[model samples]
Target: MRYKGVRFCVFTLTVFKFVNGYLMTKSPPRYVDDYDNSVHSKGKFLCLFLGICSLSYHQVSTARPGLDLVYQWKQLEFDYQSEYDRQADIDMEIFIPGQPAPIDTDVYYAANSKESKVFVTIPRFQSGIPLTLGTVTDKMYKGNPVIAPYPSWSWHRSPKTCATERIVSVYRVMGQPVHSYEIPSRLLEPRSILVTPVIDIRDKQCEDTFVYIADCQTYSIIVHNAREGTFWKASDKTMYPYPNYGTFNIDGDSFDLMDGVLGMAVEPYSPGKDRRLFYHAMSSPTENFVYTSDLRNQSIFMHDPESSPHLFHVQDAVKEVMDGILPKKSRKIYEAQYDTFVKWCCQRKLENVNEDVLLVFFAEKSKTLSSSTLWAHYSMLKTMLNVKRNIDVSKFYKLSAFLKRKSEGYKPKKAKVLSLDQIDKFLLEAPDKDFLMVKTYRGERRTQSAAEAIDKNGVMYYGLMSDMKIACWNTKGEYGDRLYSDIVASDSVTLQFASGVKVVKNLKGAQELWIMTSRFQKVATDTLSSSETNFRIVAGKVDDLLFGTSCKGKKHITGGTAGGGYGLISTPRG
Candidate 1:
């Protein structure tokens, strides 16, 4: 009886395998043999084997390996690129409010190891490749559907024009719509929104609160209030048909009111009982701050949000105002114009009220030319959040300008030259390991040399003062054992090394060919090569034409006079 039972089970298994094999063999191959020798073929086979095994033991094996998931993700990147490219036009236009979300919206989501597992395993059981797996479309999870990698709502707003959707909405995982509120038209439209992390404020464990700043006619709009549109001025606060805007017109000295606010940050961990919000206007060098408790009130914000009550305060900490944070090094570097710096400090204390102090580095002018400028700018940015006092930005800039002009006539002392020993020591300790300095010695008279060229074998050729004298330097970049200097006979000399030959063309006469060594050293040839072709170019009559290597490694060779002609010479690799 036992033998009979084992035989019957074996026969049943054999028949099941035979039927499945017959069905699989009848279908044409889904994968092509064109990639049989490629790396992709190996991957495809590995995935197929794993998929088959997974199906057979899926009930027993509940967990997938991390590496398997990574391989699947890499494959998906290639597959999704084509899908995204084909649907770009449609995807770009689907960001409107109350519309169907784009398929690639999950790109904005924060990644999860758990989600990665779903990406690898779920598709193996499906019939075809998944268009939306390992993505927010897998509706099994909840809460802020891993904030989509590319939020669909972001497309509705144009940062250039500050135009955005009127309605603001929230969503859970899987693109499930939650609560959405339409902003009242009477309030200042949100040019940008910043949210603070959850914290204790107003005696309440306040969750993240949104901070919105108005999109005024500055920077992005690039126009004045009168010309661009209606803006509220302190002088004219009468209710206009539209909401008020900030003005940053420095030429007219009208920066008293809040102009364009650009920079903003929130204190995540505050030592004080109240949380603080910090911001600064691009039009003025003034910093301002307010308690989060006062700004977070729904009633106060809904009615008159623009007119921030007593909660708003100018930045002032440790009696060390904007001047304390200004770049001191800039005063020495820009001796004549250092006082012209528009100075203001934006201070923020993050870790504790007095612990991690962040300050904004002040700029001397619109252009920052030195490390001093960058240091001051970055340091000030670190501290701007905790500033406690309002500043007169216009008055400060105006006074700085006045002081700069007054000090302009006083010439600063010349910088002291470094001695030979000091220069050598500086080079020895230089940070760039590949840097090797070379000195060119021109005997007293700097000649009107046309150009210089270097070759692949470390040979350098240059004209001394006059284009007639062509000299070669060895690998050490000095006139050494391999040095070759010769005065080529020509009225207007120009030489080029290429294609195993050197050609010297006299701008006033005909071109001559030479046998060039592998080192790019020109050797006289008795006969002109048949490969020579006539080359002539007319140029300007400018007497002071200059030729040199540009910072970008291209030679800038110019000729003639006023209407100068330009040409470049490059070293050929051997």
Candidate 2:
């Protein structure tokens, strides 16, 4: 029975193979010898052998090694079969997976296995080209990893080197050599590049063109014209040098034919238009004057000096007072009156003292006072004049009046009582022949007194000589006896005499006595009171004292004997 079963199986397999071969042969050939012509022809032949085996075998094998081999062979066969089936269906219908079987025709084979299997169909005797299996693990083209030696033709060519400097290089496209005109190094280096060709419309020929290269680095704006052959650089133009002038530059706007201009003035007649230079001028520190260049008439027009009207006229009388030519008292009065006049004239405008007018007034008044006083007065005037015109005048008026009153009332103190040292020094320094008088304090009055004696102790004073009158003064400078006395004692006395013969009263008796005066002689005497008085030498000659008879002449005396004399009389023995 096993033998019979085996024979039957073999016969069944044979019959199936015959039927499959007949069907395959009867159908139009899907591919001819061209299908096996590829470098994978060995794989294709193996696939054909596997197809025959599948049809010839009656039982399916599931053993490990057998199943594996069968699986591989089946895979190969399926590939060839799919190719044939694809070609057969190409014209009539699409060979889609899971498609319904065609009615009355078995177009696709249904597998008995539960899992679906995939297959490929190829033709025979195709071109012997190597197929791309998949990506290889290794190399990198540019920065990207590539599967093959060559990528798609769409891949952009990358630059080898890039710099900021300008450079030129040649590139190859396919097998043709392309000449790259000079290109800034700033281009290239990027993954992608955009090239724009610039054409000059002015040129009829298309030869006037340029290539603009842009990359990721920076956008370079260049001017390129075929007429110019290649490219040209475009940048800002250089500035021109300005004109020079010595101490000051010429003011462009101020220039005029008549006026000398140091600066320019620009004026615009309308908006959005060029400015016009109308006047040329130089500024002055003194606002009264403005130097200008006049181009119109070629002559300068100076404003009048008297344009400012705050000026006050100083009266000549007042000027005289300030100049000190007028007496002190007169000057004081004049200044007061002048200040009053100024205050009245200035009124409201007085607040802004016309400086020029004030200056003129000052100059005129300056002639009156001392130079020092003039300066001080001028300074004060200037300060007062600096007050703004808007300021109230009442306050300044009151102040000026107050100042004038105070000045008029001011008085300096007088000195009293000359010191003893001062008197002595005056006497010592005075000529011996001259009558010198020293001032002295007597009661509440100051009186001039003469020095009677200058002893080693201190100065002595007596009557003062005034217009030939002898006014007696005591040591205390009190009014004392009018005539001389034979014996008197006091703290101090001053003496003066126009004539040497002067009468005196003897202290011993109430009787007139005469003392003889002598020139360059000294005498010491003692006498009885009545006898001396009775025999008093009424007009005895004396020198240097009570001797001269001439009122204004020098005195002289001769030696003579006197009655009852006590001290020796020393006279030159001639």
Candidate 3:
């Protein structure tokens, strides 16, 4: 008894009513449209067309539409402050099966609309494609469109203290509803629930269909035989929340809580399967999984409270892979910050590859800037090396270091630090009157000591900044008899104006002391004497300068607060 275009398969006789009872009668050609087209279109007509072709083959086979169901819970654009203005948008999209590429859908739960005042909470799906959705509705709006004699799932606005009610509905493409049920809130608590596929828990009296409901917040999974009117939490520590997995606010607790445990996924299987896995991910980066055998079996988990599932440290997995690619010694030289790189690798299914090409690729793809860019490259290389372990670990590590150092060592030219006399001479001599010349230039800006110290010989030493690195007078002017010139290097340098201006050899070199003499060189060394007006300035926090011991241990009166230097000066305690 076969039809004209019928091709029978193993999966048959499980056809629930077609969504909207819409069926295609005309026996069309078997592969008229491309298989890819049917996958994206929900193949609504295609599924119906296929249904006409064969009575069997109820389930529509979709392509590798990884995570076809996308459920997004977002707050709607409405006044949330007022108790009457409770509004939120829950978007649920199901990808059309057997599509060459994924496509978007107009289908959504119209909870947060002008018509309905129902606040949807805890949406969970059953197994298999075109599954039923169970959602809890807080209440109905006062001015809703529904007339009297209200529907089965319909309820009037109740007292504020009462909990919400649940609404279960089977939805198809384009938000078409096939069947719906309104379960009381008392039967199923609405928050953080994962509903498993219908299972037959038949004993002798009757065949009972049960579902495993897991509440992440309650730290419990309940065995619910809805048919037999029985529900109880499975006595297992495995169902509880991880010690660190809970809600925490980024901004201080002024706003509402961002609940954790995004949701859970149950592996699709026949009614009576013993071994199955239930996967759950908190709001954090990590995801964990537990076996259904332990979750379902009351005897094992109930008694042994210690039994819990293995927790997967996603970042650690990436680190382990990276460790295998680099040598033990090489690991200490580089910082293995490879979380983002590992995530990218995971998404691309890039694993067990050579180090050279991958390392170069990771460095080029990073968005880090300045010296951090080198670290980014190092991290990417480390992660990529771990991506594939086929390469020799020691050889790769050596090669990685070579490539990193070679690329990172290319330093850019440093900016020139002009002497105060040179800058001051340029400002005074430059033809461009607008260059570094404000209206109140002489009144506001003046030469100021940046660093100063008195040597044991009583020579007054000081470093002066005429202006704080203002760009003016592009051409190199004449280098006057400047007090000190700082040589720009790969790192910050310590310059001393003593004798001939010299750069200190080490980073932590002795504090620079400049011998402050008269503006003209007429004053002889023998007759030179420290002035009470000469203030000793010590480099303070970062660019700041502190006025230490005054010259001759007396107060050095200044025209301004340390003149043009922006650095804050500390009062000498002594």
Candidate 4:
């Protein structure tokens, strides 16, 4: 079949077929020239034709390009600045919580160039009552609301809110409406209102509990107790009386008495407990002294006026004056003085009081500056007491000695001489230092000016010079010549050799020996040894060297002689 004015040719064969349409011309396969003998040749040909058709269709569809389309997602935004400007024009009525109605107010803009103002109108009630604005009290900022405590008014910041310049207002009518006039700065935003409850401690009976309040700026202490209150003024005189109590004289003027100042109360300790109320009263501009008041005995005692006119010590005397009264700065001074006095008394042994009292005083005083003064005072007192009592006072003397030693300067005791065996052990374990020197008798020497350890037993040292030279000594007991010439020597040799030593036992049955050494290293020597030859000096061989049966008599012997070669051999004579 053919259409669209095109002719169609169709041919059919058992092995091949062709169809020619109006769009294209078809060719028929010749069985003789193109047909394969394979069984699937016909199927392969059909498949190839179908693939070509499909490829052509796809190319034609893709080549026809129309309009392109793209899609993307975007967020929607509103003009916040425009909205803010619009809202700024509208007048919003402000009303406090738990109030009746909004009050008419005028909004004032901040000092910016923007002319911003809004007239807030309050609607009238149907009852025909005239509206009155609440009295504007004070302004607050941030969380702090300016609260006026007085009637006409002084303003204080509210403790709860963080706001600046809060206009605190009071209503003639109870619970009237409240409103803010305008928002000035960023800090003037109204958040919340706070009402502080009034408190009166005098109306309430608080037993046993004590209250203390201090003026941090003035360093004044106000103490209040349950029973009564006393106010110890910052001045010399103690004002306000409560109960019968003792009075302590401080610097002959300032008296410390028990009284509660402000709301705090001071409490007294139990009787017989050796409790005392002490005060460090600052008298005049620069004068300060300690006052003590005893609560148990109702007596006040001051420190010895002669010893310390500027300082006074009272023992348990402060307690009577300030017991049940809040302790103040004055009380502390008094207590300190009492402690000082007690320590002084005990240290001097003036009054036969219990030692525990002195111990307690010292222990308490140790917690203050008065402690150092008390220690010095006690030292002096102890010395004087010992002299008066005719006591040994060695312990006190030793303490003074230690303190004296420290004051002068600390000097290390001289190092003791080590035995040959000790020296060997030390050298074996000790590390080497550059300052140390080691020498051998074979004329080999190694010198380290700062050595940590040295072995000197194997070397025979002659005489030591400032330059660490080894010099030989002559029979005249003088340094004769340089021995071990040109050998590395140390400024300080640690070893020496003594030849031809003589030992003699004097009439006191004591042996005394005169040792003539060719060299002397250290000024003090506690041990002697020989490097070579082992020989012992028999005790009975030299009767003069032998002491009698009495060991005490041998100590008086002045001289002794013994013979040995190379090595040290100790022989005790009976």
Pick by TM-score: which candidate is best? 3
Worst 10 residues of 4 by lDDT: 46-55
For each candidate in turn, the TM-score is 0.23, 0.12, 0.25, 0.13
- In model 3, the Cα lDDT at residue 462 comes to 22
**Candidate 3 segments exceeding 4 Å error:** 1-153, 159-208, 235-262, 270-275, 281-285, 301-574
lDDT of 3 by residue, 208-304 (tens): 4344443444444555443545444443333443333222111111111122232233333333322233323221222233434435433323333
Error of 3 at 153 (Å): 7.4
Off by over 4 Å in 1: 1-111, 114-177, 188-259, 270-272, 297-310, 314-574
Please give the CA lDDT of all the candidate structures.
0.22, 0.20, 0.25, 0.21
Q: Rank by lDDT, descending?
A: 3, 1, 4, 2
Clashing pairs in 3: 36-100, 39-97, 39-98, 39-99, 62-98, 63-98, 352-388, 353-388, 461-514
lDDT (10s digit) by residue, model 4, range 267-377? 123322222122211111011112212211111112211222221222112222222232455334434554556456646555433345444444554556343454554
- Prediction RMSDs, each to the true structure: 30.6, 68.4, 34.8, 51.1
> What is candidate 1's lDDT per residue for 505-561, written digit by digit as tens?
222222212211110111111122222211111111111111211110122223222
Q: Per-residue lDDT for 1-574 in model 2, tens only?
A: 0001100000000111121112110000211001111111010010000001000000110111110000011011111124564455444332222121100000111122211111111111121111111111122322222222111211211111222111111111111111234433332223212111111122233243332211111222123333343442211100001121101111111111111111111111222221111111111000011111111101111122122222111211122122323344543443454454365444534433443445445445545755545434543343223221222233444444433443465332332323233444544676746833322211211121111211111111122212112221122111121221111111111111111112211112111111111110000011112211111111111111222111111111222323321111122111
